[model samples]
Every structure is written in structure tokens, then in C-alpha cells.
Target: MSGDDKYILVAQIGGAFGVKGEVKITAYTADAQALKAYSPLLDAKGQPALTIISARPDKHGLVAKVKELATKEEADAARGRKLYIHRDQLPEPDEDEFYLTDLVGLEGRDADDKVIGKVKSVQNFGADDMLEITPAEGGPTWYLPFTKAATPEIKPAEGWLRIIRPVETSERDAD
Candidate 1:
């Protein structure tokens, strides 16, 4: 697959651990320990990038030894690098279930079934997933909370995203 092929965010490198090459990692996988199973994790460019030789659970995350890293300084230098897996590496989603990566490129439609935009990407800035939409009429993109109410229906198989307009809130509304 090309570098632009879909890649799923699985984990992120944290600070170095101990004096060895081991580094702490924050895994986004459902089973944290399962991170090692996805060997040779890919980087943003879709290249085989990392291998976890071993890992142990820590209070904050996982302390992992990387195959390519042999010193604390090496691990520290790799901190903040995101780890991913090719989309094809994942098992098929169960019925009515979908990976966030599947949301990209789907049509974003309003409640009235009008094409408002296209899904550019799915993002999470620590709170929750947000859908980045490229407007159909060609303006700067905007983000919509990927909540059940805001995106009530998302049929990835059918290339559709049903959007419900969010209620406008003001400072007064928070009073």
C-alpha cells in the first residue's frame, strides 16, 4: 500500500524508561498488552517502523523495549512518535461497528439528506473524536463532535454520514 493508505493510530511513544532502550508507551488499543502483538508497527508514512521486544504494564502505561532502540537517549529521541498499523492488519469490524479510520472520505450529509461536506479525517485532541469535514461548497474545513447526537448515523459501507446540527450555545446558556 502507498504511504497515503489508511493507517490506524494504535499507540504513541512516551518518555524513555530506566537507562535501557525501554520506553513508556501509551497504547490506544482496547487491550493494552496486545500492543506487542502488532509487531513492526508503522509510522505516519506507512513504513514498518517499530518492534516491541518486550513490555510490562506501568501505572501510566507500558514500559517497552524496542528492537531498534538500544539506549535511553535513543528512546528519548523517539518520544512522541505515533505508532500505527496498516488498515489491512485489522480484523473485519463486527456488524454495526466501524473503526474511526473508516470515517474518512465518507459523505457528510445533514439531517435533510443534503450533502454538506466530506469527511476529511477523524481526530481526538484528548477529549473525544471529532470529525473534520471539508465543505461541499469549498470553504475551509470545520470540525464536528463525533457524538451520537451530532453524527447519529454513519454508514461507512455505504459511504454516508448523517449529521444532526448541534444546538448553538452562548455564554448566557452556560449561566
Candidate 2:
């Protein structure tokens, strides 16, 4: 994978917190405070962007002071900018645990080995996670519920996953 693709988005700048350069941050890490530990955050292009000078838990998320950002306007301008870190910098996940980014591009298959599509993205719209799949046959993309019953297998090394779709029930069928 390319270096840019090897980075994981860990947080986003919410907005300026105070008159100083401190900005509000919404961290995506397991521990919100751990954002300080992952210093020298990079942008999407993999260039060193923001350095966390100090960070503290806030009512909204976490307030952070960035190096060189000395005014509220400077920090406010950075709002919505995402912070990423190289995947190699992160500790590996334990067995049965996998990063969501790792799931992208894996082939979607069926129990009988039928090619469904490739995983486009994993998203959560205020509900359970959903796997967006691009049809291998060149059709519109669809989402499959990211549940054990829906996706029976996830073999990333093998470059594929087995999906067992839930049965559809109509009123007539139910009768």
C-alpha cells in the first residue's frame, strides 16, 4: 500500500476553543486523551502538520494547543481538518480484533465462493456499522450490516470475506 493509504485518521479539529490558539478536537482513538501520545500528527498527504503542545478533556471533546498556532483564528481555520498517523506507528491489534481501515478493499464473497464485490468503506450513520460494497459486476454499491450473522467470515490475508445475507420476509412469504 502507498504511504498515504497507510495512515489512519485519528481525530478532527472541531473549532477554536478559546482566544488562544487552543482548538477543540474530536478524537477517534480508544482513549480521547491518548491524542497527546500520538504527537506530530500528519495531514492526509502524510506531511507533518500539527504538533500537540498540550491537550485536555473538554465538555465537547478535547481542547488542544498546537505548535505555531498562536491565535484563535489560526486554530479556527483548522476546523474540520483531520489528523492522521502512520499505521506502522500504532500497536498491532490482538486476535479477533482488526482495524476498520484494514477491511477496505477486501473482496466480498458468499458461502459458495461467489464474488459479491469489494469493500468500499465501513460507515456508521448513528446506528450499527455498515460495510459499503462495490459490486464486482459493475453495479451500484450496497451496504451490508457488519454483523457476525451477516458476515460469517473475514479473511483479510486471503483478500476476501464471506457474507451470509439475511433472509427477506414478505407478508405473503411469512404467511
Candidate 3:
């Protein structure tokens, strides 16, 4: 299949865990445990698929065993390799929610409907999500919070998001 028809990356093998061929899987899913149900994962080349034999929480990731991998050395060898699932395997998001991948390339406009830039990427730093927008004029990127106040409108079908700039107020003198 072409790259466009391939899978979306969701996880990666961290390293070997125990002597039982269990490998550490760092899941990129919002709910790490839910990743098991989204298997079997495809490799980067779109071949050598792997299924989750078992999965459980370990530190910040999930400890899992891939089907047919029966040795610690074999599991370790797959460390650092990314895991992908076919796009069709993923469920559709609920209303008002969107996947990070779906937001990339969408245009960004100000409250007045003037185009500011295009979304280069969506980032999360544990607190809140951020939108990395590349200006149309080719200046430095802008990192804006993906909050309702900052982003009031997100019309995915239109391939754009409307952002509202925060108002600055001057401090008044004491009465």
C-alpha cells in the first residue's frame, strides 16, 4: 500500500522487561490500556505485523508481549521500534473531539477571519494541548493553547480553526 494508505503510529517498544519475553511498550494513546484493543500493529514498512498477547501498566508505559515473540532477546531486539495500526482500525472520535493527526495542516485564522497560519503540529505537555502554527508570511512559529478561549471555532470540514487573541487590560489606579 502507498504511504497514504498505511497505518498511523501509536506506540513504540521501549525495551525488554523480564525473562519471559515481555517487552515494554510506550503507548501514545490517551488511555494506555485501550491500546490493546487496537492491535495488531504494523511495522514502519507496513509489514511484519504484531499482535498484543498481553498488556498491563508498568511505570508510564505498558508491558506487553507480542504474539510469536518467545524470548527476552527477541523482544529486546525490537526495542525502540515504532508500532502502527491501520487508520481504519481506529474508531471515530466523538463530537467536539479530534485526533491530533486530523488537526495538522488545518488553517488558523484570527477572530476577524483573517488567515494567520497553518497548523504544523499539535503538542501536549501533560497540562494542556498546544497548537504549533506556522505563519503564512514565513516567520517563526507560534505556540497557542488549544483551549476554548484561545480557539473558539474549529471547523474540521473547512480545514481551519478560528483563534481569539486575549485582550490586554491596563491596571487602574487605586480609588
Candidate 4:
């Protein structure tokens, strides 16, 4: 399949482990360890492909050795390089479940049919998912919660999302 046909993304890569060219990986898959099974990871440009020789748990990620990398220096050079697999390699998720990548480029709108912005990206900083929307006319980007109440409709086919505006509260009534 062509590179564009692939939907997988490189999650994370670790620094060189030992002189034998072993590195670490942190996959975003539900079963992180299963990433090694996907083997033959592609680079961002889809030029170089890497094969996982062995992968085992080490601290927060899985330590792995890739074919063709026979020295610590080579492994160190690959540090921070993301490994990508074909999107088809991943199992299908149930309906109502969406990947963050699928949300990108989706249109954002309010209840009154007014255009709000376009989804640039989705960010998660521990608590909840945040939708980063960039306005059409160069306005400041807005971060809105991607909750059921805030985002009632998400039509991926239409590439649009309907969001409810947040209600602001005044502090004066607290006194």
C-alpha cells in the first residue's frame, strides 16, 4: 500500500540501550507490547523501514533491537525517531469511538449554524481530550473540551463537529 494508505503513526522511540544496538519503544496501542508484532516500521518519509528483532519490557517502555542497527551509536542516532505501521494493522474500534487523527481537518460549528473553526489537532494533558480549533480568518485558536455535552455531534463523513459554547461565570456573586 502507498504511504498515504497507511494510518499508523510513530508513537515514541527510546535512546540507545547498549552497545549491541538495542533501543526502546513506547507504542500508543492498547497493548504496547504488541507493537513488535507489527514489525517493519516505516519512517515519516516512508523511505527507510525498520524491523524489530526483539522487544521486552524495560521500565515504562519496551526495549527492542532493530535489524541493520548493530552499534549503540546507530541506535543513539535513531533516538526520537518515530516508528509507523500500516493503519490496517490495528484492529477496528467500535462505533462512537474515534481516533484523534480522524478528527483533524474537521469543521467546527456552533448551534446557530455559525462557523467556529476547523479542528487543527486534539490534545490530551491527562484529564480530558481538548479540541484545538483554528479560526478561518486568522483568529486565535480555541481549546474546547471534547465531551458529550460540549460536542454533541461528530460527523466524520461531513467533516464537521457541533460544539456548545461554554458558559462563563462571574465572581462577584460569590461575595
What tens digits encode model 3's per-residue C-alpha lDDT throughout 85-159? 777777898987777778888999987788989999888888889989899899999788888898888988789
Clashing pairs in 1: none
In candidate 4, position 68 carries an lDDT of 55
lDDT of 4 by residue, 29-128 (tens): 6676777777777777665467888888876567888795778898777778887776677766678777777788888888987877899888888899
Candidate 4 CA-lDDT value: 0.78
Once fitted onto the true fold, the runs of candidate 4 whose alpha carbons sit more than 4 angstroms away are 1-6, 125-127, 167-175
* lDDT tens digits, residue span 4-94, model 2: 4588889888888879778899888878887788888888888887888888898655898889578899988988998888888788888
lDDT of each: 0.87, 0.85, 0.82, 0.78
Clashing pairs for model 2 are none
In model 1, state the lDDT of residue 33: 86
**Candidate 1: lDDT of 61?**
60
The residue-level lDDT of candidate 2 at 136 comes to 89
Off by over 4 Å in 3: 59-61, 165-175
By lDDT rank, best first, the candidates go 1, 2, 3, 4
Residue 7 local lDDT, model 2: 86
